[model samples]
Target: MSRRAFCERHDIDEQRLARWAKNYPAPPRLAEVVVVGELPSARSSSLVIELGQARVHVERGVDDELLARVLRVVGSVC
Candidate 1:
């Protein structure tokens, strides 16, 4: 049924419903994603971050500043 029909059947004020909807919107819908390529193997010494079209491999004992810089660059590009 249409929103108007629903409101009419329930005796709900459309203006109030509109205000409530604006104040409390529905949660976002998530899209379904399919992985076409093989994922990297999990290693004890490193971590992998997938960002859109970019993949970040972080090894153990990596410098914080360097990782931040790389993430920043990848984030911008991806």
Candidate 2:
């Protein structure tokens, strides 16, 4: 059955339904999904990295680039 016929049979107000439909539009479709990189799982215990009174607590599976920069700063200064 058509929407109008169904609405009529169900005793629904067509004009009110049409107004609501116009007011709230349907969600847009997603054209494509891109996966940049999978996130690492949380570690059971945090890893403590000490740097001369300054400490940085990190979880497991940290990015290599971040680790490199941190080490360079600590090693260069100390």
Candidate 3:
């Protein structure tokens, strides 16, 4: 059925629905990455993680708990 009819049946304000739709759009589409060169060696000191459009570079000597927390937060948002 129509959006207006559905909202009316559900006791929702049409204006509020419109505002929510305007404020929160759909999630973005994911893109594919192609690597042409050689990958990093196993002896590299740092590690890189690609989450969505975010690139997290973690160096050596970082705390494991702190890194886990950071990844959790970044993962939720990204």
Candidate 4:
């Protein structure tokens, strides 16, 4: 989904969205970082990190280490 669409749908702040986009995990190819307000299971906020040209779901988990690994892969791709 487009950034605008995602932000609007989730009622996310435009500035926060911009920051997320700018501070994407190290990998250039795996660029693009997004934080969801709810995890869908219990509405608990969780972070989602994606990679690849189209953000082809490299990894997903609530743990920071896992997310970091995913970003590392993305960084290597960069």
Best by lDDT: 3
Candidate 2 regions exceeding 4 Å error are: 1-45
lDDT of 4 by residue, 1-78 (tens): 766886797777766656544555542242344655644454435434444462534333444445545556665685
Clash number for model 4? 1
| Model 4 whole-model lDDT (C-alpha atoms) | 0.53
**TM accuracy, model 4:** 0.31
Number of backbone-clashing residue pairs for each candidate, in the order shown: 0, 0, 0, 1
TM-score of 2: 0.36
lDDT of each: 0.63, 0.55, 0.65, 0.53
Point to the candidate with the largest TM-score.
Answer: 3
The model with the greater lDDT, 2 or 4, is 2
lDDT of 1 by residue, 1-78 (tens): 666886798767876555444433352222344545664454567767777999898997786557756766786688
- Tens-digit lDDT track of model 3 for 27-56: 322235464466666676886778889888
Candidate 2 residue lDDT tens string, 7-72: 697666877446434433452221232423553345345566565676676666666456655655
By TM-score, rank the candidates, best first. Answer: 3, 1, 2, 4
Runs in model 3 with CA error above 4 Å?
A: 1-42
Error of 1 at 40 (Å): 12
